[model samples]
Target: MRRKDSHDGPARGQGGGTGGSGVTAVTGGGETGGVTAATLPVFLFPSELLFFSEQRRCHRRVLTLYNPYSFTLDYKMLCTSPSLYRVLEAEGSVRAKSCVDLVVRHLNVSPANCGRRDRFRLEVRGGGQRGGREVWAELRGGEEGGGEGEEEEERKRRKPGGHQQRGLQLPLVPTAVRPSVSQWLLCVLLALLCAAVLMLPLHTDSGSMVPRCLHVSTNQKLACAYTLGLLTMVFLR
Candidate 1:
């Protein structure tokens, strides 16, 4: 954080000397109307940022900026090492009583640059006034130890006659079995045949266009009912 101060003017004094001669001197004065970085009402979450490169190749972190004032606030982000990092939505306006999220990504994360430190500046302007705050960023992990451990495990796995336990392999089964086009057509034909058998007139006394031999009997009616029940189950399944 930095401090800024404003001064009115330099001190001036006049002294009377012998023979009507005058002597004047100027001196520094105290600071007045000064505004410090801490005086700003900007709110930032996780003032310090940390990235673990050993966890992933690309590391990303979110920085939140909150505006509690009644008026909107404009903000901009500045990085000390611009080439090694990327910022999403680096500059934006935050509405009154709202917050905005900025994504910071470490583009170059490797073992060579571990434990690196950088600084970021968040400058805010609102209500004809400007202020800024500094944030520290550090990259950790991704050391030679992690790489050596991975290499040791690989060597063990590649060793000859070294038995490595394998996980149980299970065949994947589908949750639901769908009927194909041919199966659906077969079902429709079976439904039509069942409907025709059930629609046949049971009594010869009743006038029906169907022939006498096609009339449904008691046993045939039971078989048709069973077939219809089976078709219903198949459709529901």
Candidate 2:
């Protein structure tokens, strides 16, 4: 009801500056708002995505997002070539100070696409902020091309630092073939049969009263031994 307040606009402006723009500010009045806007920087483990085109028909890799902030963070993944890749849970929220794994699958895995390069963008938003941060990572479709020397250099370049956060390494190809239970049982049976054949009497003494039909010839024993040896070798292999 009194004179117009000339300081009203300036006071509102100052409040906006401290509350909206000063994301890192720690003022008593705007501490919560500042923290919400200034979210802890999210990190991506491995920093790069690699797919083996020549190894399998489909390639899948995991990309991890670590949210170190005390508040929850919303993240969305964007790819340069969406048709060739599929990201599971491309848009989701990670809890405060927690990590989330994104399963990225390469749909078009072929020798022709080897060495192809792509880019991925992670947009993280928190604290009800309008605009958020963007993190970029590189994606390679296939194994590095070059000789052993070049491959060594590439390996050195991708080595993680001591302080860097790393995730578990996943195998690109299936594991080695292992013998099944049935195969083991078969091998054991063959071993027992071989032993029994070797224990048979190759010749019957003239003084013995054993039936002549029961006598095993030397040639028969040799043949059995040879056959069992071959079978053992095959199963062992």
Candidate 3:
């Protein structure tokens, strides 16, 4: 709507180049045609439709479709492998110059069937419905998310004060001095010691003892108590 001494040219790293036509470069590089805007539908989505997440049974993705026309537009989404995916709101009508939402749900793909890329088509028809426009989005596989309890269990390992730190690793000592053998022997000895300690009778000033327990001298009584204390400590460790 204005005149200038300019002409659009090969755009370098700078100003609106030199051209009669106002020039703007898209993110990935493209030129928009004013003539085509009236017939085109604007759609937004991920560059790669591949899903790597498994946190839910279905991956919900929202597709925003805008109608640039002066009249309402009717559109439907379809995919080559319809069985592998679902559209929560597959078809819808958008008011003139307004936008509507379409949800493209990515169903769970089998592990073996994953990582394969596919395309889904969006078909749109304008006012007179005499002609139409079709665009396909290509989706590639992305990193997957974990299932339930999987992420939580991993977080537990990273959190402080955990069962994760309770792992028991055997000593790398020589076979002759292997810790397992030593522990087994020690456990057996400790068991016997505890039984013996329990059977010892408490010494009384009158030299009386229960029939189930043998009477022990005062010195022996002290030794029995020491043994019991040591056994408790070992088991706790």
Candidate 4:
């Protein structure tokens, strides 16, 4: 007796576009979809910078400078902190339409200084070029989980606006990680499986290769060794 509704599910166009795609949107409504999820900024570039005197002593790196102008160009290398890392042969001249390699070296650092972080800058100036090209570098003595892009951006923003700035750095101490419940459960299961295999009926012909500790009448040492070995193997896994 009643007329059938034209719509199949929830009605559309009831709510305006400002709030969300529709009231039907289960989650991530409106501009939330456009927003980027925040993530850690890192010094993502890979470079050789480590302190291992016994293995590979002083760290060495090279930077190539090119002069495209018709006249000769003068290049100079500068460091933010000279103590952290040094510029080996900093001063040089590059001929017109030519390039030269700038070599830099790491100083003798004690193992006590391991796991420390430092940074430096090398600015190259030339009369022929309109502006100096700057190269930013960092020294990492040990494995540290971190990134530098976000902090640098924040520093730049605060510098222009004259605000009190806070330094960003990686934690010197590594965060401790605890084993999860699933991992412990998996380890228990593996130990039980190993025990079951070792405790099977010794009389079976299939297990002849297994140590005959239980059957031996005179010696118990072999049996003790077998048991100890089984436990050691389980723990190792």
Candidate 5:
């Protein structure tokens, strides 16, 4: 059987660039003047091939094939995705070479092979927002996608919250300290101290009943106690 190999240069910045490892300068002109789309760098797989051979196992027909570039065991089956088989049938054996060739060129290297039955792991990487910072994503092989692809799809499905812009990160919890019972306790303790100081000065001078210090009036003593208590609370807080 034959294989029709193909790859779509993923949508620009889709999955954050997983096609090629080089920077591509996108230039354009507008009313303002000529402009560049900045340096867009990405990693990609070029030409590749998958070959399936028919054999008999336990008196039953079986097709055995493996893509060295595949990232999952589920797609390791020789005839996994039925749609791809149709493409192979359409292109025939000879044309499949072009498909494989494209992936190789995109990846910036000649492809490698470790026997026809060996599984493959293909990945593309590119620099992200900052210069020379690279991000990698494994390429999905066969007609079906793999684990990484499913995760990517899930990300696309999620919508950003109100504070988060389309491409921006969402803020977590806010910075303000939460209100709690300790603050209330501090206020209550300060009030009790003020009441005690206000009543202390009213009692007659006596060794056991009167305060031993300066005989300030009830209001003054209460005000002083309130001030000191407030200061202590502020410092502790």
Candidate 6:
């Protein structure tokens, strides 16, 4: 198993720590977990930044900011809140703390109203894994509340160095994806097959063709020939 350097937070040195080595303080009336409080760096599109324009447009009532980095989004909430979705879809990065505040104010929503609301507080503490490299990536939200202390310790025990594995383990079996070359070849073969099928009748004559002044092959003979040609081409490929 390979080990990576862990990220403590902005306050900690850029790189250099071993397994589960960060302190995050949680002070809200909500449940606490193992995530450490840290500032996450994110790139944002200009459209997302317009979330701050609450005072200017749509009155002080509507303020939108699109986080290029997504949060734990509730699809149901999103469907209900089109404006919020629009802000998130526009794109840009802001402090997670600020985002939480914006969410509270803009949606007039309390944590109780949002699904997995407390989990979005990953911004409050650097709860997820970060690597030594300054690369950007997405993290799946873990369960909210409970098992955090045990999980963190388990994570630490697994790694002597502070770096934790930085991704989610998908629950479902992954669909098999065809190799790119195979996919391309299949597309080409299909296209050729379609073209051959289309042209088959034109190249062969049917008994009906002679009566209509149409010079064309019968569908059955054309199909056979097309099949043979296609098989030959496939074998060659």
* Candidate of highest lDDT: 1
Q: Give the alpha carbon lDDT tens digit for every residue of 70-126 in model 4.
A: 555443444444555554445544555555554556665556655554433333344
Score every model by TM-score.
0.45, 0.40, 0.39, 0.33, 0.19, 0.16
Worst 10 residues of 6 by lDDT: 131-140
- Per-residue C-alpha lDDT of model 6 across residues 48-119, encoded as one tens digit per residue: 211122122321122222222333211111122322322221111233222311222233333333332222
In candidate 3, the residue pairs with backbone N, CA or C atoms under 3 Å apart (3 or more residues apart, or in different chains) clash, namely 7-18, 7-19, 7-20, 8-18, 8-19, 49-139, 52-143, 52-144, 53-145
TM-score of 1: 0.45
Stretches off by above 4 angstroms in model 6 are 1-171, 176-178, 202-237
Model 1 C-alpha lDDT per residue in residues 1-237, reported as the tens digit of each score: 111112322211112221111111212221222222544656777788787777563387777776777766777676677777777656656666667676778888877778888777776888777776666788887523544456677887778777886566799987877889999999989988987888777854368787777777878877987998899888887
Each prediction's number of clashing residue pairs: 0, 0, 9, 1, 22, 23
Worst 10 residues of 2 by lDDT: 9-18
For each candidate in turn, give its C-alpha RMSD to the true structure in angstroms. Answer: 16.5, 18.4, 20.0, 28.3, 20.7, 23.4
Q: Residue 4 of candidate 6: its Cα lDDT?
A: 18
Model 3 lDDT tens row, 130-233: 23223333333433444334667778888888867756678888544334877868876876876675566665634444653466676775776677787666
Instruction: Show pairs that collide, candidate 1.
Output: none
- How many angstroms is residue 200 displaced in model 5 relative to the true structure, after the best TM-score fit? 3.5
Candidate 2 error regions (>4 Å): 1-40, 128-237
- The reply for model 5, stretches above 4 Å from the true place, is 1-44, 49-114, 117-199, 202-231, 234-236
- Residues 59-120, candidate 2: write the lDDT tens digits: 77777776666666666665556667766656666666567666777777766666677666
Which is better, 3 or 5, measured by TM-score? 3
Q: Give model 5 RMSD, 1 decimal.
A: 20.7
Tell me which of candidates 5 and 6 scores higher on lDDT: 6
Give the alpha-carbon lDDT of every model.
Answer: 0.65, 0.56, 0.50, 0.43, 0.31, 0.32
On TM-score, the stronger of 1 and 4 is 1
Worst 10-residue lDDT window for candidate 5 reads 88-97
Judged by lDDT relative to the true structure, which candidate is superior, 4 or 6?
A: 4
